[model samples]
Target: MVFEDLGIMPAILEALKGEGYINPTPIQEKAIPILIKGKDLQGCAQTGTGKTAAFAIPILQRLSQNPLQKQGPKPIRTLILTPTRELAIQIGESFASYGKNVNINHTVIFGGVSQGAQVDALRRGVDIVIATPGRLIDLNNQGLVALNKIEIFVLDEADRMLDMGFVNDVKKIIKLIPKHRQSIFFSATMPDSITQLASSILTQPQYVEVTPVSSTAETIAQELYFVDMVNKRDLLLHILKDKELKSILVFTRTKHGADKVVKLLERESIKAAAIHGNKSQNARQKALNDFKDKKLRVLVATDIAARGIDIDELELVINYEIPNIPETYVHRIGRTGRAGQIGKAISFCDSDERIYMRDILKLTKINIPVANEHPFLPAEGNTDLSTAVKPKAKAPLPRENRPRNHAYGSTSKGGNGQRKRENSF
Candidate 1:
């Protein structure tokens, strides 16, 4: 159904149209009505499902209808708490886009960057505050943010927050806010812990779920490779020989692993970048922007970035390192194959990682076609990693070794019009 049918006002409808948003996503169709009616909502949906607009639009409408009429600093009426700074910034962008006609002021607060700008924004007074758990609590403790007047509270990506060990902070925030506030809770998965958290905050909440994390989209073709750990990098380089695989998203399990992938690809003259927890905020954002603009063809990232990356036409995702968590595999591949676009996910499973792959397949309930003839295929017959039958894996042509200490201060591109990794975040 269209946004018009979901009770959105003309001004907000015009704003949505400006963003080229046409039909409502399923979550928007189901949750928007309930939220607009001032009801608590529990939404269990994964990223790329357009869940942000489901609540953003209605809140914009509600705030516009009853504009705050105070002359002093504007009390924050809405608070959106997300797990990562990227997600919080993206949510802020959504609010700015959807609330263009609503005349509301909002600021995003997160760590890793200096708090000078954030503190200034908070002191200047904002109608809405979208923040991460740590930065929000820090500001609250410093007496810069008072949430007692929050009317609409949003606990987004609840599961991720808890996974990041933000449960106590979340509880503290909840206790500070008025209990009568309208709460909107959403998680990609509904584990028992997430359910308990939702129950604590939501009052008779309407439930709507879509795109559960365990299921992969049918449009994505999953390919598996049996390469040993040392040869996994070689398998990645071998796969990159295909010129058709443009704009690839590579996932690694550790921050150092992501950096290593970027270094290997850069030495091959293959443009790449890495984003993880340790990278400076500017570096991570710049790398992500470069990838999105198609200046960079490949982006290597950790699971912290698994969610909240909403790139259009992203079609290839390579898992250089499979995650132990089965659900993360879903989130990783879900980055591609979005908007019904045909996507491909290539996973390299070493003998040690076969158990992880097995759990992923079992969770998704789909058989991934394995590639047995790859150059890096373990020399031994392809067998379950649990079994002690393995041979050597192959690699591509040799590359001279080079030392890496620091080089995140260049933004120049060369070699086949590919954007080189000037700064490996």
Candidate 2:
């Protein structure tokens, strides 16, 4: 349905028009009306589903309708808690963009940087505050933030926050808010823990499930390359060299791996950047901004750092290393194929990652095509086909001594020796 039919105000409608958002997404269509009614909500939709606007628009409209009159730097009236710094910033941007024509003051806070600026912003008074859990707790503990006046509380990406071990922090933050306030919980998936948490926080809330749990977007072309670990980087470089690949997102399992991948790509004179927890906030943001502007051809990111990357027309997502958690596979691929646009997700799987691939297929109930003939795969005679045979389960190696079969070489070994070990192990 058109956004106008949803009863959004003239200013908001104008803002939407300027932003070229004429219609609402499925999640937005269902959740916006329910949210505007001032009822608690439990939203089930993946990232890039326009879920941010679903809540942002309603919240902004509600706040505008009932402007706070508190004198000294109006205390925070609405609080939004997100899982990662990047997501928190993106949500704040959504609020700013939608509320540009309306009169609303919002600020975002997160760690990985100094707190002086965030503290100063809070002191100046903001109507809405978007923050990561850790930084939010820190500010609250330091008496810089006041949640007693909160009218609406949002827990965005609740499942990811829980996965990042923020349940205790979330519980503590909830206790600080008034029990009478409206609470909203949005997530991509609904595991038992998140479901139980939602049940406890929401009181007869309007339930919205635009997409099924553990499902990937239908527009993405999913494929898996059965390649030896040693060749994954070379294969990635080859794909990046293609003139058709305008922009690409690459996912690695760890921050070090992401950095190493970026370094290797740079060594090949390919413009790339890496973002993860270890990077400074400015660095992460710069990389993200560059990638979005097409100033950088590739961006390698870890799972946690890649949240809230709302790039339209992202054509490719390369899984440099398969995620152990099946649900993460869905999230990684969701970065591409956004807004009904066709995209491609290419996953690199070694002999040991077959089980991980199987688990992801079982969870999503979709069998990705096996692409064994990709340039990333070894020559026919070079591959050890015996590794694929059953009845000979390989024994697990010690974690420290385990082969570094990642997208880039690790410190455990260097040069061609590591490649030899990777092929033989």
Instruction: After the best TM-score superposition of candidate 1, give how far the Cα of residue 390 lies from its true spot, in angstroms.
Output: 24
Q: Residue by residue across 1-425, what tens digits does model 1's lDDT show?
A: 78899899998898677545778888899999999998999999765577888888888888778887769887889999988765665576567657766677688777766677777777777778888888788889899888988999999989988877898989999998999989999998899999999999999999999864588999999999888787887788888999987799999866668888999999999999988655654687799899999889999997664445677899799998877668779888988888889999999887767777887888899988988777877866665644633222321111111122321211111122322121100
Each prediction's Cα lDDT score?
0.78, 0.77
Q: How accurate is candidate 1 locally (lDDT)?
A: 0.78
Relative to the unseen true structure, what is the C-alpha lDDT of residue 14 in candidate 2, on a scale of 0 to 100? 85
Model 1 spans with C-alpha error above 4 angstroms: 211-221, 226-234, 243-344, 348-359, 370-425
What is the C-alpha RMSD, rounded to one decimal, of candidate 2?
11.4
